[model samples]
Target: MKLFGSYTSPFVRHCRIALLEGQAQGTLECEFIETDIVSSGKLSPTKKVPFLTDTLYDEKNKAEEVELTDSASILMYIREQSGLTFFSSANDYNLFCNVNTVLDAAVNLFFLELKDNILPTEGSYLERHSERVLSALQYFNQQEYPTQAPFSDGELRLACFLDWGLFRKRINIDGLDNLQALLKAARSYDIFAQTAPPEGA
Candidate 1:
């Protein structure tokens, strides 16, 4: 199996963490290929990072290769294939949705700031995006989240998104104690420490 994506992307990082955790449990093994989005255009219909290609063996010993495009889909596929429990319950699934909201808003703001040269403070559209980012963070911070060794997909993605948003200066997380504590706890895991986004990103 092979995974493709940039090191700085939280979406990609979440998948990497899942694979890492799976491997730690002796359930998964694969290679990660760091590919630039522009250069990876030919790799998938979405032309995005975190693309996956897996070779599967059938009952008859026939080899079949499968491709996955979306990060969520890729993660789900990894969990199913490896029998690794990525989500512990419906609440975990709900938390994943909440964290995903933050990621989506932050990503839009990130691209708007970087690619379109639009700052959040400069327009209502961008400002709304910032509002969504803060709302999600504030709500998540207040929740009594469960602690999972190797981190649940929601926990992993939340910490990665917070770090990335902070690094990019896309959102301000003032007085978010729970969120801060979550990040600190997540770092205790080697997967998060090793898969952290590059410095100066």
Candidate 2:
């Protein structure tokens, strides 16, 4: 399997963490492909990172190809192929959806400010986005993520997105007490520490 996207992307990071947590090395080898939106133009279709390609033997006993665009799909593919329990129950799935919703909104706000160069100078709309960002952060902060055991996909994805937001200085999440605690707890994980986005991003 080849994973295409930059390390700075939270979506890509989620896929990477899922791969590692699932222990699907032999069946799914990850190859990180760094791409620039302006130059590569590959991210235009989905306008997102962390697309995946899987190679496997087909019924004809020949190597077949499969392509997955969304991070959710890619994560599921890895879990099913590896037979790992990344999302074990209804609660787990619900939490995963919640975290992903925040991630989506956060990323949209980020692009609205940075990519499209539409940073709100002054207006009620600016306040709306800001509120959304904080609400998402606060929601994550309230969750009780298990610190002693390996993190679930939901936790891993949320942590990566929060850290990226901080690294890019996209939003001021400092005032959110719960988010700060979640970030601190997530830092204790070796995977997060090692896979942090490149500095000065």
RMSD of 2: 2.6
User: Which regions of candidate 1 deviate over 4 angstroms?
Assistant: 146-148
- lDDT value, residue 90 of candidate 2: 79
Give the per-residue lDDT of model 2 (tens digit) for 68-173: 9888888898877777765877777876787677667667677787767776445576657667777777766675666543777777777788888888776566
- Model 1 lDDT, full chain set: 0.81
Instruction: Judge candidate 2 at residue 193 and give its lDDT.
Output: 79
Score each candidate by Cα lDDT. Answer: 0.81, 0.73
| Model 2: ten consecutive residues of lowest lDDT | 36-45
lDDT of 2: 0.73
How close to the true structure is residue 84 of candidate 2, measured as C-alpha lDDT? 76
How would you encode candidate 1's per-residue C-alpha lDDT over 21-125 as one tens digit per residue?
A: 677667577988989968679887887788999999999999998899989899998888777775788877888888887688788777877798888899887
User: What's the residue-level lDDT of 157 in candidate 1?
Assistant: 76
Segments of candidate 2 deviating more than 4 angstroms: 24-27, 120-127, 173-177
